[model samples]
Target: MKNVLFIAVFLCSSFLRAQEGTNMKRVIVPPEIVKLAFEKEYPGKTPVWSEEYVGDDNDEIRYEAKYDVNKTTKALAIYDNLGNLKAYEMQISLSQLPPKAQSYLKKNYPAKAIKEIAVVVDDKNKTTYEVGIEKDSRFYDVVFDKNGGFDVIIEKN
Candidate 1:
């Protein structure tokens, strides 16, 4: 079960990353509704938007907005075609992570410098933590549950 979940998350993140790469070459304007929703929800913020197609036929569309919450904090918001928020993530300091998560990283990845840490909230309001680490020029996301228990590690391909 754990493996399955890990694979699923990996595939989804990979797809999004792939889509992002593709988007960089060509500008894709988001739907008006999506833009309006974002404006209403986060007034006075401009974001770089990208689209991701999902579902069996890849007909369902999702938009991702990347922006800075402040000079030091980066944030991302994912919304459906109708503009409903699917998930939100924001960068945080290492000290912002749960104590157990910090200890786990210290013990398991000794001497490794963390690249980024984010707190993600899904549509269902479930919270998770993702810690980015690099090894041998490769990047990986080590995810932990709300309570800081180890969840899964997703490697970027």
Candidate 2:
């Protein structure tokens, strides 16, 4: 009787652990969204690679599609399975920033050095580019917003 009770308890514990492991909260992306993004990003070619619901169960549901135009290169796109474009980044050999932005930085901080730069595009189609510079043992964060048509510059003292 003692041995039987111990075995039953062990089985119950194992079953509970298994259930907990399987209960992962994950976002569900519809198939239509994936199809639309793929079509928009790649017009003539079919997707060479596709993945649905990547990442852990607790992570957001994202669909990734890749297409290859040549043997050594490929293009990649990531979209929410529900058709929302989260973010897409591509590497380029050259920088294609505006001349005005370059002149502004050069004129204002001639002695300063650029530390980092980042561009963020929100869901509402708004774009913000941030430029970080370091000068005289201080850090500056400059932000340029596309929709607002304004520049916000902050200096850490």
Give the best candidate by lDDT. 1
Which regions of candidate 2 deviate over 4 angstroms?
1-95, 147-150, 155-157
What's model 1's TM-score? 0.81
- TM value for model 2: 0.38
What's the lDDT for all of these models?
0.72, 0.47
TM-score of every model versus the real structure: 0.81, 0.38
4, model 1: CA deviation in Å?
12
Model 1: per-residue Cα lDDT over 25-91, one tens digit each: 2346788998998889889998887776655576767787777778877777778888888777777
- Highest TM-score, which number? 1
What is residue 95's positional error in candidate 1, in angstroms?
0.5
- What are the runs in model 1 whose C-alpha is more than 4 Å off? 1-26
Among all windows of ten consecutive residues in candidate 2, which has the lowest summed lDDT? 8-17
State the lDDT at 81 in candidate 2. 59
Q: Which ten residues in a row have the lowest lDDT in candidate 1?
A: 7-16
